[model samples]
Target: MRFISRTSSDGVTEQLFILGEIPGVLWTPEDAAGARPLILMGHGGGQHKKAPGIVARARRFVTEGGFAVVAVDAPNHGDRPKTEEFAEVVARLRAGMAAGEDVAPHLATMHTFLAGHAVPEWQAVLTAVQELDVVGAGPVGYFGMSMGCGLGVPFVAAEPRVRAAVLGLLGVDGLAEAAARVTVPVRFLLQWDDDKVPRAQGLALFDALGSADKTLHANPGDHGEIPEFETGSSLRFFARHLG
Candidate 1:
């Protein structure tokens, strides 16, 4: 891993890092020393590691919650180059939609392909970050929604280091099996009137989680209209489990 640049303010230090093909940002409180709990954040599809929401959450975790935060771009998103599989999937989805054909299957296939690559990349980043003394080591947690949830479920399932998660805003198709494997405590968020994900599917996904300790926070809104108060709730959730 390599540090490209770092900026500090208000007691928080945000640094840009590159781990081979993966580019990420790490946020930590300047005064923090030794090992501290880490929260791995994932951004929604079409958003990069530096998306406003991701940055805000990272800052909140580091400064207010006293935890280190990291976020990396998912495959075919942000600074990563687009893959042939992703291009083909998008083309097929567009053609299918134009032809008045059901594109649900295409969407599922794309999600699976993305998640397959994303899980390992996340693992690689985790491994690389652990070697950096600045991050130290403690408990780890994850927070993401929508595409983040779709990929995060599998990543969390495969990674034992993660002890808690905040996931939601996704359908159950490609995620149910992985969700069944996640044994960590999770707080799943849902937008009750999501236009893309059906209510039944969202509920089913939450039910699939293997964790005995899981909570669902469903609010009235569309996919992008997540209530702001939920952010505070998630910060508390991470603090309780990972602090």
Candidate 2:
């Protein structure tokens, strides 16, 4: 990983870096040293690694939990160029949404395509990030919702480095098999009124997790309307598992 630039503010330091083809950012306490737990965050669809929500959560994790956090731009998003195959899939997805078709299948296709590449990319990023002195080979956690959860389920399932995860806003369409393999502690968040993913499907996904230690947090809201208190809850979850 090659760092491009770094800036510090509010007792946190942000570093932008390029890991091969992946563009990512890392957040840590200012002047931090030695090995500390790391949290890898995956942004929702159509969002970049530095999206406002990801940054806010990263900062809070660094300041409150004293953890290092990293987020990477998924393929075809942010600074990465879209492959022709990915573009075609996205075009179909947009067309389906425009025609008011049920987008679950389209979203499933998109997530499948993205996860094929994202899982290995996350593995590589984890390997590289952990080599840094400021972020060592300590326990790791993952945080992703919606598209992030779609991609993260498979990645976390395949990666043994991850000790815990905050995942939800996705259903069991194309991810049930992977969900069944994730043995890490999981805090699954579901929106009771989510129109994007049905409540039954969300509950089914939660049911599919193989972890003996899993909790479901359901609130009345749309897909993007997760309650703010959940963020604090996630911090405590990671602190409890990773520390």
Candidate 3:
């Protein structure tokens, strides 16, 4: 995405276009100082870069938390080609329900999609930011909600540059290895009543992580609650570690 335009308060008015084969908007303040921490946000399923409230959250990071934000619309979501075949697969998985089980195949497909598209896009974005000397190329933070978190963990572990993590909404997977390898602080917020996300998965991830500074917070909410059940707590985690 290339910088296009911006004019928000707290110096967060600059907009850039992320020129991917898949494009997106990078709305960040023009700050050369890498002193500010960053949050690279991954989009949720069926949502895009222009999805509701993402920019507002980005603005909050800029105006209040003193962080730069980078958010992307994941593949097949938000400004990308809608792959109905993928949706049909999800429906099939839903139809074949089992005891103590929900939709796992859908999530598995999500992992596959992110591995191929979103993660690479994020890596490219991080590289681009470094090349531009944007915000002085400081350490970054990762915040992935829902399937976003599933993608974020592996990215955090693989990138080696991400300094902190907020695994929002989504429980955990592929985190143990990352946690053991990463010195970065990690915080997980698992909502109690999340229908789509299995609770045990989160617990397993929490137990598996070896990071000394890892934390797991359980609050009441479903998968839909935002900036409240877990997002704000996420901001606070970024503030503490990334700040």
Candidate 1 TM-score to native: 0.95
Better candidate number, 1 or 3, judged by lDDT:
1
**Model 1 / residue 134 / CA error / Å:** 3.0
lDDT (tens digit, per residue) of candidate 2 on 1-243: 999999999999999999999999999999998999999999999999999999999999999999999999998999999899999999999999999997888998999999999999999999999999999999999999999999999999999999999999998888889999999999999999998998999999999999999999999989989988999999999999999
Best by lDDT: 2
The C-alpha lDDT values of all candidates are 0.88, 0.96, 0.68
**Model 2 Cα displacement at 106 (Å)?**
1.1
> What clash count does candidate 2 reach?
0
**What is the C-alpha local distance difference test score of candidate 2?**
0.96
RMSD of 2: 0.8
Prediction 3 TM-score vs. true? 0.82
* TM-score for each predicted model, relative to the true structure: 0.95, 0.98, 0.82
For candidate 3, the per-residue lDDT at 19 reads 63
Candidate 3 backbone overlaps, count = 14
Misplaced by over 4 Å in model 2 are: none
Cα RMSD (angstroms) for every candidate in the order listed? 1.5, 0.8, 3.2
